[model samples]
Target: MSAGTIALTNNSATVSGTGTVFTTDLKANDFIVVIVGGVTYTLGVKATASATSLTLITPYGGPTATGNAWTAVPNATLVGITAQVAADVAKAIRGLNLDKANWQQVFSGTGTITVTLPDGSTYSGPAWNSLTTLLNNKAAKGANSDITSISGLTTALTIEQGGTGAKTAAAARAALGAFSTAGGAVSGSITAGAAAGIAVAAGENNRVEINNVTSGVGAGNPVGWTVYRWYTELAQTGIRRAGDTTIQSYFVALSGGGGWEFLRGGNATASGTWTSGSDIRHKFDIEKVKNALASVLTFNGSIYGKKDGGREVGLIAQDVERACKEAITYNGDRKFSDGTVIPNFKYLNTAGAAAAYHTEAIKTLFELVELALDKPDDARALIASIKEQSEVIKNTPIENEDPRKEAPPIFDVPSSEDYEEPTT
Candidate 1:
């Protein structure tokens, strides 16, 4: 049944039609019979179809009026009835509902079906394929296609799990620095080669040989190899606080019942400990005494003295003040005839001033020593100055004396009678 209308213009190739006979109802290449202007024509074949229009291969007779009745016609047949029956049979087969078993029977033969993946890899096999096998194949293809063997691995290797790309070993090493060689130096269970000479054990018995050769030929000189052994031990029983711990405790422990002597020095803590054999103790003693003498020579009245309640001795503030006062020279005030008292020369009574004075005194004393060694004339002049000061001190009067001509009487008598009245 058709409820279609065609409105054609003067053109004979295309006719505009509005109808229910479009793609849903009629397919391309389908023939339709139309009657226009009361003339019967079987002229148009559907080239394209839409809901409201049909594009025909050849337009119907031009200027056809609207409301033309049209009907879908069976394709023209070669043998008339046979062709029509065959077409009907084909349409019936297309509409039939075939179940899975019937479809399997129809597609029973094995055939190759190729499928392409997103990564441009293809899989070819029967339609039914193993999911696991397909996935493994995809992974293998990805690994092979993306990257082959990576090169340029030498000094080190970096296995970066998540980053832009693989980094070179040298680049990683440059960033992180070299690994420590201490791990390689460790003695393990693996044996050394025979070319390594003798293997040294981890004890005092381990020794290295030294070769000594004489250059010139003279009398045969004695060549001897002496091995000196020094042993020390430090032991403590209980835990101690960091502030309470001292070097003396460690020294006592390390001495191990030997005759130990302490050498005082500029360093408050013990510099090092010595066992019985070496001259470290003597060397330390010399250094300590020399340093002590130096300190005394430049004393400036300050000494490393003990605090009132504390055990350790150091330069105290009061002592430093006293040293400053002693080292600086103060000039007395001058009085002029005009009755103006000029102030004494001002000097800073400070540790820095004291140190400067001490340094100057040391320098002067050293100059005197140099004079005594090399310049006798300068030494004599210095000695003369000392003698002149000594003479001035020697001649100075100890007590004041009266300048009167006659000796003054000790007691005053009230004339001659004052004494005579006292006799009664």
Candidate 2:
């Protein structure tokens, strides 16, 4: 026995041999992995040892049947190993190995797979491949292609049912139908107002003027009416368009006869049916009316014949008063022929300042009358004193030229002409 050789443990002894120093040969707790009689076993530490023989026990395994090796612990879960290999292969295909140098070394350097490429070159490691193939495989086709054609494309490129997706290239290339008519269209409804005939003649300045009227000559009847007639030569300001001109001036006088009529009445002057009493009410205040007319003495080339307002106002008042008085007569005791007591008639009651104006109109008339004809100052004074408020008084008589008197025609030619013999 070697002197230092000692028991390693309670179940173990260390021994030396003559030719071998066991201390140099033996190790503690190291399995002696050995094939014995074609059976493999992992021998535990020798509990006791003498020269060539030792005693040991196998803790993890006994041996294989024909066991050349212990079967590698059934390769430690074959399904799991297979799955790991498959995952590793997929990663390798996706170039995942490039992300890890260790994985690249594991696959590319000396290992189970000494993988060589088809080109007789070994795979060094992961290399980048083009995404073009993957892109092509996942690319979208148009409406005509199968469902899988759009599998991996963006949502904007694909369409589901009832989608209002924009037109495709082929669809846009298709022909469009023609428009219904040539130019752009318009909606219906449009036209004119009144008819043409019986429209008033132009240049009448849209009014009917009458002068030189024979009594009872109506406004529209005999083609020619009085000059200086009220509505004649009238102008309607700002009325444009032919139809507007006609209506503003001479509208067909509406009558109970259900036809067109004219203005004026029986035989007093060239007369038609005149407008109502109100229409000519200003005639009652004839002085004011005539003054207003005479205010615009000359209108568009026609003379007013009223040379002055103060004179014209007086003459017009006298004319109206004379006409009214001639129409009615009075008897003794100051009663009218119909036996009604006559009442004094006055225009624009002149009790105060009005009295002064009334006196002025009267004075103006007497002055005009004197101017028109030769009269004594006494006659003029007598006519001026005639109180318009009460009655007409006269001392020295006065006369006036009749407005109605007509002289013979200015140009006269004899019907027979004196003829000289024709001299060559």
Cα deviation of 34 in candidate 1 (Å)? 28
Q: Write the per-residue lDDT of candidate 2 for residues 153-233, one digit (tens) a residue.
A: 343422344332435443322222212323223233222222211222344354333322222333333222322212333
**lDDT (CA) for every model shown?**
0.44, 0.34
RMSD of each: 30.8, 32.7
> Which candidate achieves the best TM-score against the true structure?
1
Off by over 4 Å in 1: 1-113, 116-182, 185-240, 243-299, 304-424
**Across residues 170-230, which tens digit of lDDT does each residue of candidate 1 receive?**
5454454433432224222333343232222235544332212222233222121122223
Which candidate has the highest lDDT of all? 1
**What C-alpha lDDT does candidate 1 achieve relative to the native structure?**
0.44
What's the lDDT for residue 403 in model 2? 31
Shift of residue 207 alpha carbon in model 1, Å: 16
The TM-score that candidate 2 achieves is 0.15
